[model samples]
Target: MSHPWFARPRPRVLAHRGLLPADADGIAENSFAAVAAAHAAGAAYVESDCHLTSDGEVVLFHDADLSRVTGDPRPVAEVPLVELERLMGARGGLITLRQALEAFPDLRFNLDVKAQAAAVPVGRIVARHAERVLLASFSDARRRTALDAAERFGRGIRPATSAGTATIGRTLSALAVRSMPLVRRALAGVDALQVPERQGRVRVVTPRLIEAAHACGVEVHVWTVNDAPHMTRLLDLGVDGIVTDRADVALRLVAERR
Candidate 1:
């Protein structure tokens, strides 16, 4: 299902949070409806963050605590997956890593591992879909551990360096950055470099950045893009992938340009 060379959809669209609230669907983030919308919208890949529950089930959730989404101020890990499911009844339903895999059946997934404790269990969950799942994290160290476990479990891991609203890749390389060595090592273990689009008032995702990451055999995926002009700019600059809220817009933009 996860074909690395599946013609690489033109400026591949990764529907963010399943195209939630942004569209007519009132489906909240981290809910099943959101995922469905993302896939239905023709997103080739769907990205979501996952956290562990008390019963050790790897449940799909974006935030670490229930305070924001659930309106309860409890840590998700402290609640058993069952209880969480009970709270998130049939409206959305709690989905385990297994459920996600079985339900989607080949959708390429990028999972953000929220905690180090999640490493082993998350690794085990994604392993079943090795050919299709890619694990990403802010913590290179945590990503390394997850990748190791994923390898043992048979899933391929992808190294990531999020630009966090800061445009990255405008610079040719991280050669001058303090964490270059660590990033290089992390890049060696994975296939892609995930980053943001803005950096200190200077757009970082320039051709040089794409060239640099590609030179190291790392594909670049830019995230959270919500506008068309910016999308066009990145594509012209040769970005490998674009994660956005408007998959429809991305698809339309590419089609119009073509």
Candidate 2:
């Protein structure tokens, strides 16, 4: 028999753009096909980035503004969802928050909040299925709004948070090396701390760091890894979960171990 946490299959893979054809239309990152492919590929769960369009509609996207992914310039807050939908290429459709919920009813998702405006819609949508999802945001304020609204709506996800990626600034106070007061305090408020395997010029998720997070009853999940050795290493270090862009490779790794 396996221990409780150990029961989780090894190497959880979150498909990068839902195992897309790599050049297919609507199979690019953050598109419906990308999300759908993630679930169909046997991902334990899926992850997505979200930003609200000008019409207060939350569209699936990883960036604050749409210039890089979108061919032309358009501020996410300045354009409505309908307009965004019309301008989409392979990877650029506007997926409403409600559509994602109703579409993937049973799958667990890590919805990364990229805009403050998204908080209210996120909270309202998750309130519809609070037990089945996790809400996260780079903005603590946004996360807090979601949490607060969940309560107002009597959604059962008061403990869920919009956890940020941990960085050195995340782990250290302005004053000195010995002072991790700010980082610890930030972690204290979050149910989990999502950090990149590499954040900025530094590498986090050391053995000691993982131990420390677990000591605080917080799960540590590292993101966007595409290498087998690194995935294996994170598992060896006993990370609570691993997020990856190459869900195909990650899923295969998980099945072999299971």
Candidate 3:
């Protein structure tokens, strides 16, 4: 059975780190404002990263440190929730994992577990809203840990998850050899394969990869594509989703195609 996260129509526009409004200057990615902007732009899916604060609270943040976003050289894990909230408040708006899920009841989320400490908490938090969330991470171990935690902590329901880096590598290797069995094995249990169209010079999301993923009942989503032409090409190539910083543009493109 398809998870509810995939119930929405294909060619999904996953707002990368939420969507920063064109006129909303200083609003950081993953902030409340960015998420709200995505919602306002008619994005059904919002892709954001997760990290654990010093007080063990789960927050929506991208980088390991606050240097780029806040000009503070402190690590996110070393800052308390109150302090983090204060900093984010001035930049845009602060939002906890629980708060975001509660606030956006109708929007689906693609959450990347960035911190090791946040894996279990993310699982626990999304357990209640399992149908509407898809968990992802570069580390397969961290991703699996969260999946297990979700099952252990909440209602015995495991939320949808995407392939991790290792899994993607194995799947690509299988595809290189035209091994459908190997490809299916590599994609087993994952609902989506979120990847860059290329890793350096090597092309990753070819027609074969998309076909193999579909064979395994997995959806292919290309990441960080912001331009309209690239978005149109990927959608033409039958990609299931596009993760983009410009949700407004992507949404318009998808609508035109429909």
Residue 232 error, candidate 2, Å: 1.3
lDDT of 2 at 103: 87
Q: Please give the distance, in angstroms, between residue 201's alpha carbon in candidate 3 and its true position after superposition.
A: 0.9
Q: What is the C-alpha RMSD of each candidate to the true structure, in Å?
A: 4.2, 4.1, 0.7
Clashes of each: 8, 2, 0
lDDT of 1 by residue, 111-218 (tens): 888877898887777666666677777776676677677678763533232321112322224544635454455355456667777656856566656766666666
* TM-score between model 1 and native: 0.83
By TM-score rank, best first, the candidates go 3, 1, 2
Error of 2 at 150 (Å): 2.3
Between candidates 1 and 3, name the one with more favorable lDDT: 3
Which consecutive 10 residues in model 1 have the weakest lDDT in total?
163-172
Q: lDDT of model 2 at residue 141?
A: 69
lDDT (Cα atoms) of all candidates against the true structure: 0.69, 0.66, 0.94
Tens digit of lDDT per residue, candidate 3, span 114-176? 999999999989999998999999999999999988888877567999999999999999999
Write down the worst ten-residue block by lDDT for model 3.
149-158
What pairs collide in candidate 3? Answer: none
